[model samples]
Target: MAQTVGDFLVERLYAWGVRKIFGYPGDGINDVFGALNRAGGKIEFIQARHEEMAAFMASAYAKFTGELGVCIATSGPGASHLVTGLYDARLDHMPVLAIAGQQARTALGGHYQQEVDLPSLFKDVAGAFVQQASAPAQVRHLVDRAVRIALGERRVTAIILPNDLQEEPYHEPGRKHGTLHSGIGYSRPKTVPYDADLHRAAEILNSGRKVAMLVGAGSLGATDAVIAVADKLGAGIAKALLGKAAVPDDLPYVTGSIGLLGTEPSYTMMMECDTLLMVGSGFPYSEFLPKEGQARGVQIDLAPDMLSLRYPMEANLVGDAAETLRALLPLIEQKTEKSWRADIEKNVADWWKTLEERAIQPAVPVNPQRVTWELSPRLPDGVILTSDSGSCANWYARDLRIRRGMMASLSGGLASMGAAVPYAIAAKFAHPDRPVIALVGDGAMQMNNMAELITVAKYWRQWPDKRWIVCVFNNEDLNQVTWEQRVMEGDPKFDASQQIPNVPYHRFAELIGLKGIYVDRPQAVGPAWEDALAADRPVVLEVKTDPEVPPLPPHITFQQAMNFSRTLIKGDPREGGVIRETARQVLGAILPGGRGD
Candidate 1:
């Protein structure tokens, strides 16, 4: 049989090492789906309930595995639904290839069913490479180029397949067929800094009395190099949220995370340091970093544009993190002073104690921090964890420590809510041998495609050795947004649009044939997690938590404090409880004692 355009494209994808494609089917792209079917087990099609979830899964797949992720959708709404997830991939610098089917060529510019300009739709997110296969011969080359660009740039690339073109045969009188099969290979280029630049960076580091390192996801492969640089300079390390797994948090001078969801120790360390060394991270929050002119900075990054994007730098070395650090280490002068390192270590230790005290504080409904605190120690080695955006993320950022061999991430740049469930689903797909867990708030789970739980139930039996746990914080509030509203606008307790109708997520999971565990009290948090972990199938452990508890920033501004006071003065019903909780948090920070009532 002569090869069709769809078959040729699928053949190229298979050759490029694409094992799975996540998406939904529609009439516009039925021919591509047919090609996928013919490919058989060469490529598995993961059918998601929504195109958005498919995009999220693909983004997470790339994030967790460091491979090119692929997702497909039909015309119009199907293609449009993928915008948000594509943005998530683009912003997070994950390599993803999105394929969308277009209306038949005959209907171009005509008002046809499900007809939308796909190239214009995806221009912003998939702007790196967006092209349509208008002719049969273009299919193979476009697919090859899209894959290469996505892999090479670590950005999203898109290909639009019109229905008519997908069915056309790829044959010409004298032209050789199957050229795509012979010429499909992708290799990432290694980048390193010049000797002079490395020396300049080292000189800046040696001139400062106190040094600090800020690592981001770009430092994932350069963990040893990062630690070596820090140890040589007696520097404290603060990881950006995306770089949480770059190094283990148990290291003496490693401050957990820095940003709005940062730890107090990390904020303190950044403020006190005279020199800052940034590695593989473009952390956007500049307020959390040292003020300009306060610290001399040196940054090392593979992308030239990101070298000094966040903080001003005296020396910017454009190179791979591991290679750059390896060269810079020899030029750095070791610091003998232990006082700076010791001070930061003491602060980190005290901060952990404060978190522990807050986690176990007695309340009518359970404190959400306790969920992460108890879950932290119980996590098995090499587990993959994901958290949703909201109050749940704050707790996960502050409470959960990423130990050696473990991996964690979220919708960091996009800060989308419904990401945790899809991210967990993708992580499980990528690493079936490792345990997968998702920490999501009640608001985020229901806002998007909670039906994705059904996808989990569908695929649970396929990977019997793996366990998937979804820990839901059921506070019946869009708690993060509620707090933001109060703090930013000084508003009284108004539930008009801030509250979510409480749903029994555990029962919902049970109805879908997954194990369910519900905990309404603090005492049940640990056992419920244990039970869910031991369950043979997928499980949803829903813990009811207090909505009144705010996820206060590490350093509260004077305006934020005034906002809280105004809210209390404006006759908020929870005024007394809020004051007591605030007092407990303040006491936890200042006192040397462990748990406080």
Candidate 2:
């Protein structure tokens, strides 16, 4: 059997530890698919319903496994479909490699069918590393470089293979045919801040009486180091959404999540802190960050450019999160006064009480927050939860407490919908024994790839256990955007644009040969979840929820408050309902024992 360029590339991918590839088959890359077929169980080709889902699955695979994820597509439309998912990986700093097939070499500059400029198309998403293999001899080197760069830089990379070159024999100069099996040399080196920069950051931290820490996804590997620093300085810890798992919410001094989907305690602590130590998070939304000159800042990141991108820094320590924190631990001075920590802890406790009161409140349509709260306690150890963007993200961020060993992720940077389903699919594929759940909104679930539930059904028999659950928040509205339009722009609710027709997602799941559970009452939320968990197959628990329940920010501005008043005056029918709900929440928070009537 003669080794073709496609076979050589697949072999290299195998050597690089890629056991599976996510993509759809297309005519343009028939040779590559042929090689995949010949690999003979050495690698699995996961055929997604759409090219976009394939790319998303790859990105999620990288995020969950911390390895280079691979997705293949044929030229033109197939390649174009990969843009959004690749951007999600690029912006979120996940390592992914996209391989696309190009038209034959002879078709170049001839305006052939399905011919598009792939380099220009991928420039924005895979700009970090994009190359086209022009000859059979170039395949191995290009694959090696693309994988190395994707892993080393934590960014998306692309390689294009022309149809003609893919089937060609590899016989470059001194190398004999079929003799290129040597491994590529690539290793990620540890980066650490210099002694002087570490000292400066430590001094900045020790100088403040009230210090705070803002953690991001970058801090995942350095949880202990971050906690140690916070303990030493008596600092309050707040997480960026992607860093939700960086620390457990049970920690008294930890403020769960910051920004719009944040808690009151986190907002108050950020405003009050004298010094802010940002670790591995370039959290945008500067309005939520401490006001300029309000707090001296110190930032630690693997990339130098991200160190001071979000806020001005008194010291920028450019190093890996765990490495930087480990080096800075010995230099930081311990704080004796615990008043600042005590105040933040008190607020956090009160906030939890408020959340509990809201979660249990009964409504005609189930309160969406209750779904997350009920599901939280039932999560098995080390569960992997994926949340879709929109209103569901708000409840997940605020109410669902991520205990140690549990992991959560969303489209933090791209903020895209339709990722939760693919993310759960990839998570389950990565760890079949672990429980995987996707908290998706009704609007998001129907967008593009919800058919992936069928994919789950196809693969269910292969796994030892069925631990995948898709809890769909079936509120018939693009609820988050609707609220934003009303509050930010003072627009009246436009039903034609904002409302989505109700869907029976549970029924759809059953039709696809999976377990289905539907809940419309508050009392059913918990039991529905239990049934889903106990099912012997993949499950979809469709929850009918109150769309009128606003996801108000922890701290609403006077203008936003006035906007709601204006909407109410303009005959926005649901405004009154939300107002009453708001009053109940306020009374619940202030009443003795944090109880509501």
Candidate 3:
């Protein structure tokens, strides 16, 4: 039997080092699915419950592994469903290639079923490369370029395969006009600024007394370089949410996370700094950064477009984070001043204490912050952590203690809900030997994550380490938006849209062959985590948490305080709980042995 175009596409993907693909199947993509089957596991296809989740898994896989992530789907809705997840990859700068099947070629432009205009639909998300294979010869280069471009640019790409054409016999591009052959393989190059630019960057950084540094996802591999730079400049390092794992929280000078879901120390540091060094971070929201011209800034990034985007920099060095920092280190003068360093460390210490005080303060059933606080010290070595967007992210950002060798990520740029469980599944699959965990909110769980538990059930036994866990913060509300509406919009929580049905999430887990641990008491949070860690199989640890506990920003504005006051005056549905919890949060930091809302 001769090979078909589908076989050639699969073979070429395998050659480009694609080992796993996350996607849902359909009749439109049956030919390629057949090809995947015939290949006999050279590349494994992990079926997700939905195409969106599959795409999220692919994005997370790229994030965790630093390799190209691949996802596939059928036509029309299948292809369109991938847009949101693909945008997650695009915005976060993850390398991902989406493969989708189109309607039969003969039906093109005739409005056939599932014959959506895939190119137009994917043009934005997969803007780097989006092509459909019309001939067998065209399939090879399309596969090669799609994979190469996605990896090279750290962006999303796509390949559309028509079902009928995929069944045609493979053919090499004939030696004629308009026919060309393309090859596989791409090795990332060392990118560093020239000696002059590196020196200029060092000069700007070295000239400052109270220096501050902000790191993001781009700084993940440059931890050592970041530390050296921070130490030499006597700078306090503040991690953007994506850079949570870039530097361990154990570092005294490290001021946890920065931004809306940020720490007070980070806000203080940015406000007070005379100079700033931003490395490989596209942390939006310039208000959180040093005011324009208040601090002299120097930035280093691989993409020139992203350089100095958040803040104007005196020297914008275009290069990889580790390489550029390594090159600039020799010229960077070490600051002997201990006062500035001491101030940052002191603030960081105080902030952690405040968080502890806040966490210990009780709520209706359990404090949300307490869940992560207890889990922090218990996090095992080499564990991979993921969090969904919402109130849970606030706790994940502020409370979780990420030690060295631990990896953590979320839907950073997209900040999309319903991604944590899928991200955890991808993390577990990428490194089956390592423990994986996800922090999720009830809204996201009901939206999509509950279905993904089945995906875990299907594949958990295959993983070497069965310590996979998804901890659900069962707050029966769209907690983040509720707070945003209250504080940002000066509106009370609208129960009609914000309320969610209470779910027996742990019971659902137990029914699916996974271990289930339910905790309603604050004290039980720690022990429940302990039980999950020691479980023989995957686990779903659900905690009934208080929704009224606000996810306050690092530096609350006067307007936000007023908004909260107005929200209460307007009579929020949960007015009593809101006032009680908010008071407890505010007073907990000041009062001795303060506990309970």
Candidate 4:
């Protein structure tokens, strides 16, 4: 049998260690599908409901596996649909390669059906490397370079294959001038900073009486090192959302999450710390960090561009998080003082108690916080959790206590909606033996997640572990944006845009052959999760939650406090519920009799 360009492409990707490809088919790329059929399942092709979901799965696969994630799509709209997901990978520094079909060579400018300039479309997302193969022989180097570059740089890259060229016989580059050959394989180098830079960072860390450490996605493999360094410096560690699993929440001095959806301990520690050590995080909100020059800063990241980006670090050490921290550990002096650590631990303990009180507060149907709070201790060992971007993420950040073995992530840098389901799917694919769960807001579920539930129905039987579950917060409102309007814009909840139709998410899941459980009462939240975990198949656990319960910031500023009152004064459609929930949840703990802003 003669090898076609598509066959050769598949073989090359297999050589590059790609075992799975997520995509949706189209007429523009029929030849590649033919090749995939002929290859006898060397690479498992996951058919997504949409191209965007496929791209998101690829991005998430890369994040979970620490390997190259690849996705394919047809030309024109199919290829264009990959932009958002690719940008998710690009922004989060995940390695992903997008293979998109293009128009035939002869029909390039004729505007034929589905004829689009794919390289141009993918340029921004896969700007590091985006090339369209002109000849059958050119496909080799295109695949090699795209994979190598994406993996080495931890960035998105793309390769465009013309439909006509894909059907041609594969040929090697000629042994002559103007001809080139590319090889397979890439191994990440040992990136570490200079001894002098390490010492400088250590000096700054040692000099401060109160040190605070901020860890992000880059700190994943350096968990032990982060703990050791924090202990030696007597520093409190705070996790950026992406780094939620970098250090266990059970640690006495660990502040759960930072920024808008942060813990009060994290907010307080940042404000009082005399020095900051940032590790591999690109957390964009600078206001949540130490004010300008209040704290001496030191940052360590593999990419120099990310160094000193969020904060003006006095010592910018360019290196891998694990390696840099290990190198700097010996230079650091251990602090004998236990006062700072004691205070941080006490704050964290008290914050957890406050969270417990808030979770049990009554709501219209169910308190959203209680859902996650109840599920925390009940979570199975080695479970992987994902959450969509919205009010659900607020609970995901503040309510869930991620243990040492559990892995949790969501749309961190992009904060995109509709990613949780696909991310959970990818996580299941990456670790089929592990149980995976997704927490989504009703808005995101309506936007895209419901369709992907059909995707789960399609592939659930093959997974050895059938504990995959989607926990939907059916709040009947775009809860996060509604609160943002009231608190950030000082405007009432505009029902026209903020209100969403009440969706029977559990019924939809049951209709699609998955187990469904609905909980409208707070007391049922825990038992419903237990039932979902014990289901024979995939489950959709839907909880009717209150939308008016504000996703309060750790500590509200005076302006934000004013915005809260202004929105109420201007009149809100849910004014009664809003004021009641706000007073019961926020004012009681954040102001007056409670801690002042």
lDDT of each: 0.87, 0.87, 0.92, 0.91
**Candidates ranked by lDDT:** 3, 4, 1, 2
Clashing residue pairs in candidate 2 (N, C-alpha, C atoms within 3 angstroms): none
Root-mean-square deviation of Cα positions for candidate 4 versus the true structure, in angstroms: 1.4
Cα RMSDs of all predictions?
Answer: 2.8, 3.1, 2.4, 1.4
With candidate 3 superimposed using the best TM-score fit, by how many Å does residue 506's alpha carbon deviate from the native? 0.6
Off by over 4 Å in 2: 173-183, 573-579, 583-597
The digit string of per-residue lDDT tens for model 1 on 433-461 reads 88999999998889874799999988988
Comparison by lDDT, 1 against 4, better one = 4
Q: What is the overall TM-score of model 3 with all chains considered together?
A: 0.98
Q: Where does candidate 4 stray beyond 4 Å? A: 588-597
Question: Looking at candidate 1, what is the lDDT of residue 353?
Answer: 90
Would you give me the overall lDDT of model 3? 0.92
Pairwise lDDT winner, candidates 1 and 2: 1
User: Model 4 over residues 485-575: C-alpha lDDT tens digits?
Assistant: 9888889999999999987899999999999999999989988999999999999999999888889788777687777778878888898
Candidates 2 and 4 compared by TM-score, better number: 4
Arrange candidates by TM-score, highest first: which order?
4, 3, 1, 2
Number of backbone-clashing residue pairs for each candidate, in the order shown:
0, 0, 1, 0
Where does candidate 3 stray beyond 4 Å? 581-597
